[model samples]
Target: MTGDHYFSAQPSTAIQRRDVEFTVAGRDYELTAAGGVFSASRLDPGTAVLLRKADLPPAGAAGPFLDLGCGYGPIACVLAAVAPRATVYAVDVNARARELAAENAARVGAGDRVRVVAPDEVPDEVSFAQLWSNPPIRIGKDELHVMLQRWLPRLAPDGVAWLVVAKHLGGDSLQRWLGDEGWRVERHASQKGYRVFRVTR
Candidate 1:
């Protein structure tokens, strides 16, 4: 064992890959997971809620969607699968996660559509039609705020961001904070102790 967090850029833990299977929107996914990435064992409860509750991009949606803090490309793969014409960017700080994300993207037959990259590699000039995240809340509020500050403004004028945070993990407070920051925030849904927020500029 090592003192490694999922957010670590290079996790030192031994990689023991596992298979994760789940269904969303009548679609099934079989992706790889490994130690040292977020939700390595199963689809995270919060992410499950986020995907189930948030509005998925409609078919024919031409997107440059952002899957912020994408762990193993679940959101990215699903978005690519659903919005076949879109470009899905899966950003992660962890190298192993990025590797798995790319592999999973290929596995889902979306290798050509998904761009799995490090956070810094995303170009600044490009804006997103949608951003979906089960953000890294454990990274602390200050860091999380910095991340949001950096990315939220990249939303296109008519774009939307769907976020899921556990209520006990400052979900309500984050919504209030987003409102204070001048973005429109709506409580889209609440399920299993998770708060789904639909945000717009």
Candidate 2:
């Protein structure tokens, strides 16, 4: 198996640590990344696009938000920093990614607000007020759709989700699919060949 695939639940490669720094919504972040994680060397372009394009949570926004497929906790940390009253859940399948995300959260002093966990570890009763993701599109269309189906429903009735996908990676098709699935999907932004989608129930 390739060591570069972020969707590997247990990456079969040695962890070689590095630093990844980026700015989102005027806030700066320097997080730890490793060989086995997603965007192990830098802030992924899709993630940067998503952060820049989506409507971030208001400072007064409260309660839980979800960073689905959180790699090293970029989105989760941003949400926690922006919405101090909220709790951010950083969910990932890769163990190495989860570890790095937790460490990054602590580094940002949002450790108290960022909860890094495996997908199934999230409490069944907890529903999210907002969801953010730069999904693992390489997992193939079927698996990607399954992942979205599993979590998108957990959004509260008034909640919204922000997603970024590369235009060549079926971004438009995904938007249509979400609409067909009964979501109110909006093409919020298109930048650098990436499509940012805003989805609501």
Per-prediction tally of clashes = 0, 0
lDDT (tens digit, per residue) of candidate 1 on 53-131: 9999997998999999999989999999999899999999999999999999999999998999998899889899999
Work out how many backbone clashes candidate 2 has: 0
- Candidate 1: worst-modelled 10 consecutive residues by lDDT: 1-10
Candidate 2 to truth, TM: 0.97
Off by over 4 Å in 1: none
Which residue runs of candidate 2 sit more than 4 Å off their true CA positions? 1-4
Give per-model TM-scores: 0.98, 0.97
C-alpha lDDT of candidate 1 relative to the true structure: 0.95
